[model samples]
Target: MQNDTPLYQLDPTNRFTHRTQDYDAYRPTYPSAAIDAILEDITPQTVADIGAGTGISSRLLADRNLKVWAVEPNAAMRATGSKQPNITAWEGTAEQTGLADNSMDLVTSFQAFHWFKHNDALPELQRILKPNGRLAVVWNNRDRTDEFTKRYGQVLQSVSSKPVGLGRLSDATPIRQTNPYFTNLREISIPHQQALTLEALIGLANSRSYTPQQGAAKDLLHHRLAELHRAFANNAGIAYLQYQANIFLADPA
Candidate 1:
């Protein structure tokens, strides 16, 4: 069944304002294989990670010894991300990253591209990227193939008054259509998983802005999640949220 109710309006300036702590704590990182594939042929000296919530993607790029500009609009998220070494956490959005024209050799956004207003952001991203720059958009899509994962989806959907469109990676039609500024689209998927206890799973849910985090809804969500965990947790009393790190790479046209 489709949820036709609109999700609560997001704050234009601080979409993840209240969810930063949970986001930093529970959001899974991109797979190393995905990272390796993104950096496969090119040696980039400078990279810009737009919508870099809590620096998860920025730190990954920094680990490769590249200078990274972790551009994020949310104050709380940017502050937490700034503490990481080799990262210059800038208070900026994908549409207005405060960087010189043609300043970056590569531009990346992990689990962030969908949030962007494609028309405005594409030009801004193109402005900052060098002639040879590549744009990579990535997301860790939850694998709902197994019973546990399907049940977990039910937990979130039960609490979500608005439909959560989490399957964006599988359909590249919109991303491909919106941005004529890019060409030679390439896609890759890397299998991944994250182990979580029941509490952590709740934390993961809280990290999503669309989910209800207060009132009876919050109570109901957590209760169902605990029940789900009890029914499906493995021998070690842990649940594995499987994912496929989907990456879409293209050259600036």
Candidate 2:
């Protein structure tokens, strides 16, 4: 059955409320090398992680001893992400952060920027940044070149209305020097992979916002995923999912 609910109607802020646990558990982390490369050059001391879903990106910044403000709209995600050390959770979104002016050294959205209203979000992001502060947007795009990943994507796409993959956010970022919002968008792709068992793979599928949440479609999706695992798993039953952690760094124009 096709889900008649449009993608825009999914309430981008609250859609993941029920799926937070799976998102925290199975969603791949930004590669440490990618993190290192992002932070090595500028050395931002105060950071605001926008759309900080379960603090996946927040914790990485906080771990480096940087003060990170996790800005999230959903209560559940904010509450969970707040418990992390060195993170201050705020109830806000990309378009309206409610933070004071010139308050941050860096503003980042990890695997989350695509969900924002860029026309509205850019100014708010710029308002919070100190002069010369940078904004980093990262996405671990699913690599379909690998056979197992292709089959895994097929399983998700079968039941999805909008499909489970990055849209135009896959390759290009909206931020650029010519744009009114930001200047000099620098992009890089870092190869990454995740090894998981059957259950972890199920959790991975469950974590996606567009994938089936429950009901017959959800069951069928999981069943097909398990079948894919059985068919594609290596001798040790490890299914490898490939990704390219695309990092885009820019400063407000």
Candidate 3:
């Protein structure tokens, strides 16, 4: 997917270092069904969670009592994730995870795969993973078909400092096929819902690296989000943000 599309010129590793608080607080969590699909037919005892920002995906595997090495290049993000139970956080990038060769049963990247240098990362993932190991990539795309979500997306688009195509929305199948390190790619989509209060919705928008962190644009983004929340939220003042959790699972080549 990245072959046909250009990515952001800025270093991906440093993008979220400043957004760590919102990222850990407001980003949507993966569904249990998605976890079931990732671990299906194989019981992974050891996992290397690449780009494991704040150990979001790492905690899922760890909760299953699996040993997880959450590899993240951002020191701030890694430090926060290191506090979680059943996880060993490593300060490393997807292209250069400091893990041994053929040592992991599974390697996963959630909401962070788009940042990887695809060519370099694929081989490293293969090197660290066992012969039958699986590499699962995941992204949660909001249901833009919904009117509120559509308007919400519009607000983000208005203030976004970078282009949207550079990130998670891109398809991973073509990207995987071009690389020899991973093959037999399979895709799964699970419905997910996030009930967010107004502040959380704003926090979620602020968590994105592409969105403006400070300026009049940031204020405008927040104002519009609040107005939309007023118009769309339920009686409980909670907005149900719908998402389709897209998952791509592939085996080592």
TM-scores, in order shown? 0.92, 0.92, 0.93
User: Lowest summed-lDDT stretch of 10 residues in model 1?
Assistant: 3-12
Model 2: lDDT of residue 117? 75
lDDT comparing candidate 2 with the true structure: 0.84
Q: Candidate 2's residue-wise lDDT over 138-166, tens digit each? A: 88888989999988888888887766334
Q: Judged by lDDT, which candidate is best?
A: 3
Task: Write down the lDDT of every candidate, Cα atoms only.
Answer: 0.83, 0.84, 0.85
Clashes of each: 0, 1, 1
Clashing pairs in 2: 182-253
Q: Across residues 47-154, which tens digit of lDDT does each residue of candidate 3 receive?
A: 999989898889988989999999988888987743656799888888899899999999999987877777788889999999988989999888888888788888
Structure candidate 1, residue pairs in collision? none
Choose 1 or 3, whichever is better by TM-score: 3
Candidate 1 C-alpha lDDT tens digits along 1-253? 6443322223434767888989988999888899899999999999999989899899999999999999988888887643656799888888889899999999998987766766678888989999899998898888889778778887888788964555543555545775667888889989988988988998998988778979999999889989988887889889888898999998888
TM-score of 2: 0.92
